[model samples]
Target: MLSGDLDISQAEGLKPMVYLVQPENFDQLGQSFVGKLLDSAEVDGRGHFEFEALKNVEGQVLLEVVVQKKGERYANRLENENPDSDNYMPLIWTRGETLVINAAIDQFQSSVTIENPSTVNASFLELRDLKKNAFLKYKNTLELLQGDEQLLEREKALHEYQAILMQFADATPELFPALMAIKWVSPEGNYERIPEFLVNQGVKWSERYPNDRWVKELAALASKEKLPILVGDQMSNLEFPMVDGSKTSLNAITDGKKLLVLDVWASWCAPCRLENRNVLLPLWQKYHDKGFQVIAYALESNRPAWENAIQKDGANRWLHASHLEGDQNPIMDSLRIHTIPANFILDGNGKVLAKNLHGEDLVQFVANYLGD
Candidate 1:
């Protein structure tokens, strides 16, 4: 149970709510976390509140406690949001444990602290605080060193900042904190170290928490990094069910083509449909006869919607295929298509040329590739 004295600076005009973060959407932190509403508490004039129902949760689940005004949207701790206005803090609530939080509502994230936390929660707090401190210390240093003459100093500062995270991630044996620290510096922040961290860190977690849901998800991400998804890397073969219910591979479609666009989209995505009409269709019309082709792969569950979208958009000229699995589509996982409208331009021999080109860039690239 989360029982504590919440010191709301102005106790009256505020409402406090608690929510459980869905396991699948845990990676999308600070985005939209309006998950299952577990409970709400009323604060007295003295600014004291409690959630008795927060006791005996099934397991160690992620929770967000937010204090917002009535009818106000649920608040998250965004990096860009004003610190004074943040009304939320993340919690790792463990079963059979009691966490007492004493915090001010106005500065919820920064002011919140727990007394005697579980192992998971303790690690979480330590890493979270470390991240905040590092950001404060390094953000200005990096910015000030942005000039070409200070490139070495900037690189040194960047490495020093990342080194802190890397060392923390390596040392913190707790699952959530290690994962959180790893994500903070992954792909963009840590770049080349993604594979190494995933392998070394992932192997430990995989063995320790083998059947855990989040562990499995992170394992998937680690596997994706191993696959060749870069420009100039030769793409592996992908086979999916055609609209006519025939199996066709991507390699088979690229025969005798100067360039091919491997378009990954979904029927339900409005932006995808708009791109089809605005960019892809025009490019297709102009270059279809000149040996430029497209294989539009839809991550769709509804076959009718898939067929209807293509028909509605008058995009029947392009070859279309799907596994009819929507977000759970195997093709999505195989190609690391976390979000679509994702695309890759390919050469005749199946090497990637460019990726995710859209709008004027798409038009310019295709036109330049296939000239008159």
Candidate 2:
């Protein structure tokens, strides 16, 4: 059970949400609070709220207690233009234990305190302070630099920032915060440090428990980072709701095509739209009738934005599909598409021949395969 007390008197009409995040997708907490809303409670006259329905939930998932504003569908990152801050705190809950919290209304995280913290979360405060201090130091030292800064000083700052993360990970190798810190150390999302850190930490843990699936899964993330679902691999048979609210299947769409280009993109991505209009659209116009097709597959969250981009790009002639789940899309996960504007060339059988084609090279590739 998770119970908390907050003085909503300073700011009324807002709601408190408890987001239950899966260990694998814990990064969602940094983004927004939507389908992850495990439970919510009203702040009573006594300034108290409680969530007891988490007993049926499995595993040691991260919890986010956020105060969402009225009329707002969800709370994302703070807008620097608006100056108002988002009120929330990260938490980890263990079953069979009661975690109590007390936080202020104005400064949610600054004055927060916990009672009966989980064993895994015991080092949270220390790590949190280190992170906060490191960020301040970065802002004061690095962010203020205009170009006269030494390359070595910059590297030292980055190293220090990274070391704080590594310090936390090394201190609590099995903790979820440690895993989260790993996400930052590797800016590309895929690098040597990811699996290296996991394996290094798991050395002692694995000796104690050889068949630990946690260690296995953490190690497995490294392979997925290599983008294993491309070049000779057959596309997964899947269907998604189109703009017309009709379901479209990838395999079904490629039925009679000599070649099909799967363009994975999002509306927010400027390069994606630019490529669609400048490159992909023209390619479709030229080669579409000559046994070629394009599936404008969107890893999008907004239906209106997705539809607007399609209409604006004049890509109505091509096939389009999306579940509108954005990062939560299962296809993106299965495909291991960590970046946008990503594409793949698939044959009639839906087997990928080449991946990430764009600009002149993409046009040349099409010409080589299906000459104009």
Candidate 3:
């Protein structure tokens, strides 16, 4: 049972509705809250609420409590303004423990305190803060180092930071907190880290605790990140809905074109944005009339960043579509795309010709085909 006492006396005019949400996917840069609604409650006049008997919800999961004055409208406003902040704290619930929360309306996190099941989560929260501070220091140190010659040194520094994060993950008593720490420190939805952090760590934990339910759950989650797509596979079709509520498919844009660049990217991806602005846009402008088309497939959780990126990056002329589920999209399941700025050059009949041909190489590929 999850029970909380809301303190609205501190800040008036706040709504009484509180929503419990589950994680769906990360926004572009491991930011934003894209999740499914699990439960909701309206606090009484005395600011009391309870979610009792949450049955059949098996395994370890991170639950978010979203309390607000204006439901959805306020959430949307936060997404538009920040695109990152959740405006709430995450509850890392473990087995055989019920989480109790006390939060005020003025500043949710500032006034919030965890009461029950504090043994594991207290240390986890402290470790997370330390990791944040360490990363900040790492960034500052990186900024001081300049030039290509020092890139190896920079990489070393990053690896050391990752090591500290891995240590924290290992030290956690629960699987969920460990996994959460890994995600918190690692790059956004990075497939490489899945193996190093999740896969490897999961195996060790599973062997150590053969009968542990949390370990099994952690392994199951890690298994989902395995790469399924390859370079030579036939390009799969995706019917993604567009900005105007209209829908478009991959086959539709690939038709009647000699070649098409299936650009898989996201708005929060700085490298992807840079390539779109500096290289892809220019190439698209030059060869658009010559049967060389570009279709930008955004892996984004929010509509604003996805749409704004299209307009801001001059990619509006080309075909664009996203489910706004980011890495969790069904399309990604069939496509097996693990990373952004990834592309597959498709032939006239929608066969994969070349994979990830960027910048001058992309220009050369199209130019070679067009005999320019």
Best model number under TM-score: 1
Q: Write the per-residue lDDT of candidate 1 for residues 106-157, one digit (tens) a residue.
A: 6666677789877777776776677667656677797676644344355456
Per-residue alpha-carbon lDDT of model 2 for 1-372, expressed as tens digits?
788887666765555443333333623434443326666666677778887678877766676666666677654422111102435556677776688888765556445678866565556555555666665676577765554224334545665676887777777655556655564454335543234454555454455445656545545554434544736677888676777789878888889999999888888876777778888889999998899998877988888888999999998889888888886787677676666667889999989888776777789999899987
What overall lDDT, based on C-alpha atoms, would model 3 receive against the true structure? 0.67
* RMSD (CA, Å), each prediction: 11.6, 13.5, 13.4
Regarding lDDT, does 2 or 3 come out ahead?
A: 3
Compute each candidate's TM-score over C-alphas: 0.51, 0.48, 0.43
The alpha-carbon lDDT assigned to residue 190 of candidate 3 equals 58
Residue 190 Cα positional deviation in candidate 3, in Å, after optimal superposition: 0.7
Identify the candidate with maximal lDDT. Answer: 1
Local distance difference test, each candidate: 0.71, 0.66, 0.67
After superposing candidate 2 on the true structure, give the runs of residues whose Cα lies further than 4 Å from its correct spot: 7-35, 58-61, 69-71, 75-88, 147-155, 184-214, 223-372
Candidate 2 TM-score, C-alpha based: 0.48
Model 1: pairs clashing at backbone N, Cα or C within 3 Å:
none
Q: Per-residue lDDT for 44 in model 1?
A: 68
